[model samples]
Target chain A: MTGVATLIRQPWLWAWVGALVVWLATAVFTGGKGSGEVLSAAMTFGAFFVIVALGQMFVITLGPGNVDLSIPACMTLAGTVAMKSMDGASAMIPVGLLLALVIGAGVGTLNYSLIRLLRIPPIIATLSSSFIFQSAAIWWNRGLRVKPPEALADFTTAKIAGVPVIALFVVVLAILGHVLLTRTIYGRGVVAIGQNMRAAHLAGVKVERIRAATYIMCATLAGLCGYLLAAFSGGAALNMGEEYLLSSIAVVVIGGTSVAGGFANVPGLWGASLFLFLLVTMLNTFGAGAGVRLVLTGLIIIGVIVAASGGKART
Target chain B: MSGRLSPRLLRSLLPPLSLAALLIAIFWLQPRTMSYFGLNLLLNLAIPIALATIAQMFILCVNELDLSIGGFVSLVACITATWLHDTPLLGIAALAGLIAAYAALGALIHLRNLPSIVVTLGMSFVWLGLAVLVLPTPGGNAPEYIRTLMTLKPAYIPFPIIASVVIALVVHVGLMRSAHGTVLRGAGGNPRSLECAGWSLLKIKMGMFALAGFFGVLSGMALVGLTTSADANIALRYTLLSIAGVILGGGEFVGGRVSPIGAVIGAITLALAGSFLSFLRLNPDWQIGAQGAILIIVLALRVLIGRAEARK
Candidate 1:
């Protein structure tokens, strides 16, 4: 009884409930046929969202003014750079992955430098830097579509007994992320800083260092997501990362993470990712047109946020 | 203190000074642009951008951002081209309704304590969806009146220049010089104090959002007039561009520090930056990147000026 009560009290529980309800609604609409397949599809797609949202959740946890607007550009640039370098060679996969991560780290460092050194706000700094990164991606490949290595592509698409291999790996990644946030000193520092920057500073936490690390970690995960996304989608496109920008922030917000910063929920990230993916699937299943789909998506997101904010007022 | 420069004065002067510098560079690269016809052609598209920047400035004045302005403007353009051209009454009603919706959205955001970024993010999708429904494949004709009004040439000055000057002065007077405007701005700088003064924070928020919507409507109409048609995604970039223009024109993210004149000048400078890049024979792919570099450079200049002021 206590376990159930505690679970119900959790902020992340709403996201899970919403996801389950949507999934059931979608299944009922389809008369229960291919329901299993739909769940599988949700997991596969939601895995990618979870990866990106995990990073975004941390950034949002840092404070109100902190967010990474360069995520989509970072994804595009990393994917473009890695794919072009790999050139479908199986032996070069490791090198490509390393390059992607390095690019992410570099972009993150530059983003922080603009904020710290030039005194530009993080929002404007990241946004301006993203334009430059996007231009670089366009100039580098000239919009060429290069195929991923066969082995890598197969691994990305591979399924194991009705479960995607990528989905399982990402679940493990989320577990590790949970541990990092809940159990690590670095994570505590992040929470403290978010609650009150001056208080954290007085507490002897290294504010700038933690901030830089968080940004770097976020960008690195974005890079990893980009590399995998390129493989999963068969190639990198200039506009491929466009939708992810909104989806990432949406997941973080809908996952019950506080927008004001200092609090985060890893479990909620998963539920929100699945909910978002399934929401789209359900809307599409309804045979709704593009305009209606968009409007509904917007409305549903607002609804979820409003519902979840009820808990916020009490705390 | 005698020889020291006020940071406030420097901030006000920077926008026009940068605009002049950009114009000089553009003229130096392409001397023919100094002519009236050339100047007119070069700045013709800047009118919509200036309007959008002003719209964004309103939202920024409240210390809140509007991610939906680009989508809102796009929807308006779609309405202007299709309905406004065919049935003027329907289009006017629709535009007015959108402004009302904007006010309502402000009220919801304020009353619910919802984050503006998230709400506007969702609203952007709604606008895009509505725009697509209105014009699925992007073909809509602008009204005759709109086209003529946009293209009207005055005696000695380019029409765009005259329009920009008018826009800046009017906004400056309404937002900077008026008494009621102070209360509106105070809502951004210190809402709690404004509330303590017996003003309704809800009303201030609604007024700000409605004003943003008004300018956004103008921006869309102007864009369709200049382009002669409308597409759902035509003004999607305006969201980011408007935000950038506001910042470039000496507007801070926090605090109610914004300059209407500076914002207009910044919009023009950005519009000219594209032309300047093309004149330099730079790769078209790198043009956007160049704009980013320009933003950083200008901001870096601000930092240097700030440091100098501090030293004094």
Candidate 2:
């Protein structure tokens, strides 16, 4: 009971509660008619962001000044390659997906190699890679758009029982992510490493491998999100993945993952994602443009970080 | 002392030397491109980015990032372009006002001792929104005089490039020689130590942020001249690119070490790299790969060299 009480008082738990309230309010305010469509869009967007956020959470939790700026770029490259190859063939959907996964893995490996081999700070290396990836996407498209197959697009656009299929996909991904973080040995090692790298290393955690894997996982998830985005949008654009960069970081941070790494609150992230979605929906409902959205997102992220830091200091 | 050069000096010199080498390579490959006219254009291109890099260097030296320069530039450019379309002096005034506004905002965040990155990020959004509200479709244009002044060359040198050189020199001297510079360095190097010494960390941080804001304005103003118009997303790449340049120049995140000359050189190197890519006619995507590769290489070199020095 005491443990439960302590957990309840955790910052992440509180954030989750806040998120719930925001979500409920959003649902209530947007009631009837296109409310369902708006909610589905929000869910799909939130889920996609969640995948990227989770990967970031893994890096942040370990806290070795770890950050991956290349995630979006990796996603962009993956989606571009996948869609470019698929070219609207229903049969090629699986192939495209597989290719995206492979590209993700390749990017992950490349990022890992740069970090481990070159010993560049993760942030700089990742940022540079991101630029490279964006350039690659631009180069691949050559100022043209790459549309995914109709079947894939149909899947992306499909709604079952008034819920977006992509939302379901996100939920499943989130559950899998939660399980991987909590139940697996690899997951435990990740947490252990995040808590204290030296201690984890001494305990045979294969710190480098784990770190590399985390990058890989992050890139892979981002890649998957990109595929879904491409399918939903019916094509891939150069800037498609760029917007998610900060939001992913924001979600993870708001979800109660410390910038320096340690414990991550999956539930908190879920709530935060929902909250963010609602917040954006509300802003859009108010008829704000992309510029407004960008500004709000940036402000909310800063606010959340400051609030969290203050809360921690108070505790 | 006669026989040995200091490692600090050597490290400080490396980026500039590399930058020179890169420029020479460009010159060798395309003499026409590196000609007086070409050099002038290149220099003009470097000003806004160089100023933005200096701003980013200030934040980074304190181990923080500023992802809001894009928004800052946009807002400043938008306001300058919109409100001062007919009057060049008003454009300059509006530019100054925007800088002051951003500086005040930056100072507020620093006083709160909050992470500069997060604060700047949010402020960027606010500014961007304001920019859109002011000019939604990039309709406004700069005064003809401002545009001509920006584009016109003096003798052999372009005005923008000359402006960049002047600003760089001023900043270099200010950062290296001033008492405030010392305090700023101390705060960045070890805030706790400075605080223990009874220095106001917040004050130092706020001052540094103000300096960053000033540079942001300079960059934005230069950009307005170059483009002759303001788009909300014009300076988006500068946010990260400036940081990259600062890091590549071998500046420490904490303020004790900075090389304005190196940063300019670093900017030049980047510009040269882009030019080289264009010259090669490689898929522009290769440029991205190259930047990433360079970052990885520079970081690796830094770590390896640092570790070697530590061992010694």
**Residues A191-242, model 2: lDDT tens digits:** 8998898999999998888898999988888888888888888788878887
Name the regions of candidate 1 deviating beyond 4 angstroms.
A311-315, B1-5
Candidate 2 ranges with C-alpha deviation above 4 Å: A1-8, A13-33, A202-204, A289-294, A311-315, B1-9, B86-113, B143-149, B156-161, B254-256, B300-311
Model 2 lDDT tens row, B1-312: 922544545566678777776767777777886667878865667777888888887777666778888778777777767777766687677777765665566555665545555566667677777778777887578766667777776886666557767766887788767877777777667778888889976667666777787888867777787788887777878877787888788876554576776676666566567777666677766886776566566666667667656655
What CAPRI grade goes to candidate 2?
Answer: medium
**TM-scores of the candidates in the order shown:** 0.98, 0.91
DockQ score for candidate 1: 0.66
State residue A88's C-alpha deviation in candidate 2, in Å. 2.7
What local lDDT score does residue A296 receive in model 1, on the 0 to 100 scale?
A: 90
User: What local lDDT does model 1 show for residue A31?
Assistant: 99
